[model samples]
Target: MKRYTKLGLILTIIVTCFYVTTASAQGHYNVLKYGAKNDSSKLATESIKKAIAAASKAGGGTVYFPAGKYLTGPIHLKSNITIYIEAGAEIHFSDNFDHYLPMVKSRWEGTDVMNFSPLFYAINAENIAIKGRGLIDGHGKKWWAYSEVHVKKIPTSRWQEEFKRLNKDVLAPDLPGWIERGFLRPPFIQTMDCKNVLIEGITITNSPFWTINPQYCDNVTISKVTINNPDSPNSDGINPESCRNVHISDCHISTGDDCITIKSGKDRSGRKANVPAENYTITNCTMLSGHGGVVIGSEMSAGVRRVTISNCVFDGTDRGLRIKSARGRGGVVEDIRVNNVIMRNIRDQAIVLDLQYATTTVEPVSERTPAFRNIHFSNITAHGNRAGYLNGLEEMPIENVSFNNMNMDMQTGFRIKNSKDIEFHNVRVNNKKGPVVEAENVVGLQIDDVRSQKPVAGEAIIELTNVEGAIIQNAFPAKGTEVYLKAKGAKTSDIVGKANHFGNVKTVVIQEADVKEKIKLD
Candidate 1:
């Protein structure tokens, strides 16, 4: 056994040496050595491309950028290459729109189409990485200023005529009207159809669109990255669309849009692609001042599944853990688990599941019907939020959601509608006005060990409308409350309550105008 162990150890050392020697032989190509100037005045686009090409010709190597400001345009990445920016190095993208000429096959707002090239783009590449503690500054003020001010300066008649001319085959049929009013902005870093990707220890700021967007890629990792894009419209931090097996951790993001958004596709174009974004693990992230801390989508048309988020902090965000979709975007979002999240000073609902995102008209349930199910949250704490809203569609209800061990201090409590199979365990809420918990058109609900503190007068602690098969046990209502539970609608039946501590409650009223069956309360 000892002889065999010695032989194995020798083999391992030999293999390690061979790998190290091969990696050394590949060599590193410095941008400055390839006619790339450190002075930020000159355009280093061609020189940087030359360096990348030289490294690629040498059979996959590293393209190193030393400590200087390299002003360049769009950089198209190749396979088996690492763009290593050293400390104090900054790749400042030029504001020249013509530099990113020749549209590429890309997705704009969930639709598959040809658009402007991203700042750093890669297609069908393998073993690619963007590492080192440097900055990638997108001079986005020029792009944003053009969209914000110059587009509005066009005459109304000319704008309408231009819209009519450009709306055909160039854009998706179901594209929103607002997107057409502005110039098409490109993402900062977009890698599509790539595998084994890594983006770490970089600070990205002032993005024209999304900061880091990886679409239709597999085995991606983004860690210890900082994104700062404040006051820029649609400047999302990191958006992973139609990707699989992604792990994002230890990221600090503050953006104008959602900090982290996961999507598949949008509308009919997305359903045709049929590639779901699945198996994501997001942890140890901090989000600030965005639309949502971690958003699923307003554009998930294919599907999203098996996402686990934990140990995240969201501060000053509009919403936290938001899942939004609408009709005509047929998809399924399931098996999402979030835990150990802390949120503070949320402007809107901290937790929202909104199915009526963009449209309100009732349409037929076809392949465009959206479905959400099997979502679970635990150990969540939030303060200074308006309320928790869960509004599902009547035709297709959100199903099988569970919340455990939650403590929230908000202006209002839960307002749930059109859902089924919901369970809340050890949940506590302190609200100012309205009922602590209100349900409409809900079925199969179980509330165990739930408490509401300092509830206002004249409002019932729990109000139910058209609820069926509800079992509420061990619930605690605040003292001096007028009513404990109020039931309405003809479908409200089989409501069994036991061991509830209603302090100084006056009556439990059941409106008999629409109630056909008597509610069971013991």
Candidate 2:
């Protein structure tokens, strides 16, 4: 075991103590009583807002809400205030549509759009908290009603007319491009240009659009929150759009769209905005059901960088840890680290990095470039049914991709396309069927301690096309076709594991006598 220095040991002890002490002291908040009888509903919103405002004015304190069903429109939060709710408190949004008018700056699918303001909207604040056990329900039925009415081909002219009618008060000529594109619609908690925000230990459910949209913020911490949104059409759980220095930990998110999507911005407008969403850390979270678990982008044209996720579980999700971007969306996603993840029953690829996203028409590849490089995954265990695909486009081949100590029990093969500087260490694919590792248009590839179960009848376990400077050092045999390497113009290839290196790049078929020790799985 590695040794720690004296200062490191002292700091670790102090941090553990501080965490326990602070957790104990967290539930101390003054409760102001309000009922729905003594003009209760009318005074509840103002009372709660006043409590939070008083806390903020007094230089940071807690505002407590006891058990009750309080009706309100929009509850604006303030800096240096903590809103704590008891476990039985159920704060409900008013069902009236007019209660939530006056649109806010938000988005959906990378489009800047508008609709009813969120139930809890804060702007440009600092050191805020919404902690403790309770529910903040954004009664989203009205918003969903509008969505269902709009999606099913409502005659183009009629749709435009309805949009104009709904947004009559919106500044017509000055509305942004996203407003025109029908994005920036609505969400539950839209916080823009805020700093040092803390959202911990709350249940947020039934959001209109993106559940918790944090745009252009810094030093935000979202922990131990259960986000539940099952309805379709723009019900994302937690979208960190154009934010920096975020840490999301110990959250269970199940939503209709991407569970926890990281977005910088979208398209040329996003690029022109020029705000890079960077330095996010997600740990100890569980993703139950969603389009994808912890997705990076289809909306990352501005940029996304330096993300770290660890000790997470993805179950029954479409994909586990996906990084996707399209062509002409100029962004660089680099230095991503995913470690200690366990994925089960993945509907799609266990780990996927695709550069061409949302392009079903398959246009001619000309000006499509999105740089993906330096991504590392380690100590991951997966059991799934689909293929594991890592695809980079012709113009933007991936660079420095590494998968170390991965044990995958899968049903399909693994593929890599148009990539460079890839490494796989101690990687075992128990496909036991066929095509374990396939690479095309690759360069600087290395596979160490890679083993697979062969198919009953097929080609080699490894296939290479137009790849250069590739090395397959070691392999283990199970059944079908063992290890085959085919490269037409591939040069400078070396295969040296329990076998000779240097010369004769032909089929150096080494027998079991020349193989190394077998691994023991307990």
Candidate 3:
């Protein structure tokens, strides 16, 4: 080893520090250095792909984009590659649809198809990441113009015949024409059949459709990402389909559709695949201007389970914490727990669990019947149009759902229909319209410390129709309560109330004279 002088060593140390701090260091392949134009004038698609090839050939390195605007088409990511965009750097994806040519295999809207490639795509890869304090713009104005709202038939919908190969048991007749109808928009960043994926610290905007979609992926973590896509059609922020071990935190999402959606697959294909989207933990997220804050299904056919959502705030979303599935989608949504969530300015119900989401036809219990059960919500506060809506199926009613310590101030109250084994503890709904709890065709309903703070005069505080067994205890009712409880319908029976202070209630219980034997206070 040769000895160095003090001055030379100091200079060498400073240079080493600078090189280590730079994003385009020796181990990193810089896009600009690989003939990628930094200006947005030229297409850098080939150069960026070349840089990724270099990095991947070198046994995995970072492909760096440093402090400039890069115009590129589709970016295909390989395994063991990291795309790092430094601060002040932006990647503008081309709007020309031809750039995404050759029609890669992609799962569009819970159906597998060979459609347009995503802006950034990967398949069957592992240990991939796209993380930096930078921006990835899809430049989706041209794509949005292809929507059916403006154009009747989009060019992307030409793959209808191809979709039939993957899934022939299509329930929706319009599934094939979805692309032509401009219903299936390509995702911004999509990874399929991959593992150990991460997307962090990036700001994504102007996505064509679902921004970050991961299909058949595992060990995915998306954190500290800011996604804003306002007034754009089908621009869901993040959708993880048939994925497991997903962790999403510290994200701020405001999209036209759902902020975060979980899907498995579509009807029979999903069941045939038998891959459930499970083991998800979503916490510390802020959602605004989206259709739903955290939505599940409307596409779950393989089943969705073991999901935990905590410490999330939803503002200006149409609905918050929703789970909806329709008939012909044979799946079970169970073992879901939500805690410490706040919702305000919700256009629809704060929490909704509906089995009749996209279909209206009633079918018999079979492999095509969807079910919702074993869901629990606690420590939730909301100010919305309605507190909650739980509408189950006539054949298979929702089962074993409980809500505890929920406080809400809404224009309307909670609506529960076609459910069983439901419990509400320490729940308060302050609404201006209708009854606090309007439950119909319910069996085994339990209300403990539950009441309407502002009960309407004419409408009963709690209306029960065709209810089999209802037990109310430890209730806290405010003054000017006109009717504490009302029971009706031919099947209504076994209304029990105990341990309640009823000094302010004008009427304790009201029973229809015709069904007096069927409905009475015990």
lDDT of 1 by residue, 1-522 (tens): 999999999999999999988867877888998888877878899998998898888878899989999999999889989999999999999988778767677777787665678999999998999999999999888777645434664334433353344445653526464455534778999999999999999999999888899999999999999999999888999999999999999999999899999999888878988999999999999999999999998888999999999999999999999999998888999999999999999999989998999866787788888889999999999987665788899999899999899999988888889999988899888888887778999999887876667767778777899999899888766577777778888898788888876556677555557877666555
Candidate 1 Cα deviation (angstroms), residue 103: 1.6
Residues 1-522, candidate 3: write the lDDT tens digits. 244587788899999989887745446888998999888889999999999999889888889999989999999999999999999999999998778876788887877766788999999999999999999999888888866656776554444444444334434422244633533558999999999999999999999988999999999999999999989988999999999999999999999889999999887668877799999999999999999999999889899999999999999999999999888888999999999999999999999999988756677799888899999999999998999899999998999999999999999888999999999999999899898888999999998888887788787888888898888888757999988888888888878877888888888788886445644343
Number of the top-ranking candidate, with TM-score as the measure = 3
lDDT of 2 at 410: 86
lDDT of 2 by residue, 1-522 (tens): 235587788899999999868854653344454233222255366666666666666676777777766677777788777778779787777656556666555455554445556778888788777888988887777567656435543234443454456655543211133345432336777777899888889998888778877888998899999998875557878889889999999999998888898988777656767787899999999998898888898778778999999999999888998999877666778889999999999987899999877553344544235678999999988888754788887766889999999889888767988899999888878774556787878888887767664442444556666666666665544544433443333332333334323232223232232223221111
- Model 1 regions more than 4 Å off: 1-26, 148-175, 508-512
Q: In candidate 1, which residue pairs clash?
A: none
lDDT for every model?
Answer: 0.86, 0.72, 0.88
For candidate 1, the clash count comes to 0
Q: Candidate 3, which segments miss by more than 4 Å at Cα?
A: 1-26, 149-183, 514-522
